[model samples]
Target: MLQLEGLTRRFGANTAVDGVSLSVPAGQMVGVIGRSGAGKSTLLRMVNRLTEPSSGRVIHDGTEVTALRGQELRDWRTDCAMIFQQFNLVQRLDVLTNVLVGRLNHRRGFGATLGTLFKRFSAAERAMALSALARFDLAEQALQRADTLSGGQQQRVAIARALMQQPKLILADEPIASLDPRNAQVVMEALRDVNRRDGITVLCNLHHLETARHYCDRIVAMQKGRVMFDGTPAALTAARIRDIYGVSEDEFDTAPEMTAPALTPAREAALPA
Candidate 1:
């Protein structure tokens, strides 16, 4: 299990994540939802050790993640992969090489690490990278430069790279926030597939209410750096949403749907499944 015990982060006088505690069982897909400045991004970053917590502990299956050092810390990061809002691909590199970067942690010694900079990977590793790309339906683009693909395709490439890590947990921060409606659905479905098929635990920070309700097994609502609600999607009713967002009933009614609309049949058929 993944446990966050009183995890808190402060910048000078501002406490970004305020003593947030959560216990996530294995294989659970959880959606962390909240408005801007609610600390959603910081929470995930802290778990991945991208940002250090002010005071608290991050424990995963009895290992005190916060206390890990050097190689241990690097290993923890490898075990817990992170997918960012912007597709963080090496724009100049080919798609296959970018995906192979995930295997860097598995390579021992400085020599092996240096070899990757020149795109020298074993045939078996190259095959594995190809397989991951195929899973995301980007096999044809394997030789293409990452910057040549569309936003949706680039994001899919990013997901394939994360798969190469063979991570136990995935922390996705606003993964689909920049995509168009159809692309957003495709990305969300891809994430759901990973959670179900590989049994990888997913902690995704989402901005859309309906998207979270649709893809997540459970939803965690945060307000002012603290969890205000934690339950299944059905339990996150209209009233609860209103309370979380601090909107009046009429305003809630007038607000736009919190997720991308359904894709048209033609558009759906054109995208990879």
Candidate 2:
């Protein structure tokens, strides 16, 4: 389990993440939803240790994650992978090499470091990286440059790279915010598959209420750096969304039929069973 006890982060006079506390059980896909600047990204960053907390503690399975440093912190990062809004890839590198980067944590010794610097992978390691890409149907594009693929394809490559880390937890910060609707659905479904099939915990920051309701097992609503609501997707009703985001039902509702004014990609997989 992951526990956040009064986790907080401040930017001088402004607090980005307030005294927020949360406990996440294993193998759960939790979506953090809110308007822009609600501190959702800051909260996820703190959990990943990318953003140091101003105060409070983050404990994961009995370890004080906040106290880890050096190699310990690097190990923690390997165990907890992060996927970003922008698919952070080496544009010039082939998809396979990028995926193999996930294995950096497992390498040691100067020889291993030199091998990684030159992008040289042993046969077994190459197979492992290939397998990760296969999960997202990107194995066929293994030799392709990451920048050459479409936005959705690049994101899939990013996901494949994360899978190679063999992480226990995935922190996706607005993963699909930049994708087209069909691509968004594809990425979301891929994430859901990872959560269920591999039993990896996923904490995704989402912008669309319908997207959150469609893909997450639980919804965590944040407002001004604090958690405003936490419950099953079924419990996050339209009225509750209105109360949290200060928007009317229509603006927040992303139901398939309700949102599909035309056959746009955004509506293609608005809801998935």
Candidate 3:
């Protein structure tokens, strides 16, 4: 299980995440929804240890995540993969190479070091990466530059890269925000597949209510840095969205200017090591 106990993040005088607490069961697919600046992304980043909390504890199973450091920290990152809105990839690198980056932490001893230094991958690792790409229907584009793919394809590649990590959990922060509706559906389906087939725990930050309702096993609504609602998608009624977001149902459904909230400078530098 993943537990957040009184998790909070402060940016100077402003608190980005305010004493948030929640528990996520293993293999559950959760969608976090909130308006812009609602601290939704910050919460996910904190769970992945990409952003440290101000005052609280994050525990996975029995391990205290906030206490991890050094090689422990690196290993923790491998165990929890993070997917970003921008599809953070080495744009100049081949698609397969980017996916192989997930295996960096698993490499050991001199041969692994030398292979990485020389940009060489073992045949078995190459095959594994190819299989991950194939899962997302991107094997044909494996040799293409990551920058050459469309927005949706790039996001799918990012998902494949996360799968390559063989992680116990996935933290996706607004993964579909930049894609069109069709592409967003594809990405959501891909994530759903990862959750169901591999049983990896998935915590995704989403902008659209219907998208969340359609793909998530549970929906967690946040407002002003606190969890406003937590329940099955079927329980999230139109009136509840209005109450949580202080907007009418239609306004929440057709949000035109919503964007992934930015991180504070203190949190920005806390990216996964």
lDDT of 1 by residue, 1-273 (tens): 999999997765567689999999999999998876678988998898877788899999999999999999999999999998898999999999999999999999989988998889999999999998898889999999999998888888888889889999999999998899899899999999999999999999987888999999999988778999999999998888877777753454345334223334364335432
lDDT of each: 0.88, 0.87, 0.89
| Candidate with best TM-score | 3
Candidate 3, residues 99-212: lDDT per residue as tens digits? 998889998778897887677988998999999999899999999999999999999999988888889999999999899989999999999999999999999998888889
Q: Top lDDT: which candidate number?
A: 3
- Candidate 3 global CA lDDT score: 0.89
Using alpha carbons, what is the TM-score of model 2?
Answer: 0.91
Which pairs clash (backbone N, Cα, C closer than 3 Å) in model 2? Answer: none
Q: Which stretches of candidate 3 lie over 4 Å from their true place?
A: 109-111, 254-261, 264-273
Cα deviation of 203 in candidate 1 (Å)? 0.4
Model 3 TM: 0.93
* Span of 10 residues, lowest total lDDT, candidate 3: 256-265
C-alpha RMSD in Å of predicted model 3 compared with the true structure = 2.8
Off by over 4 Å in 2: 250-273
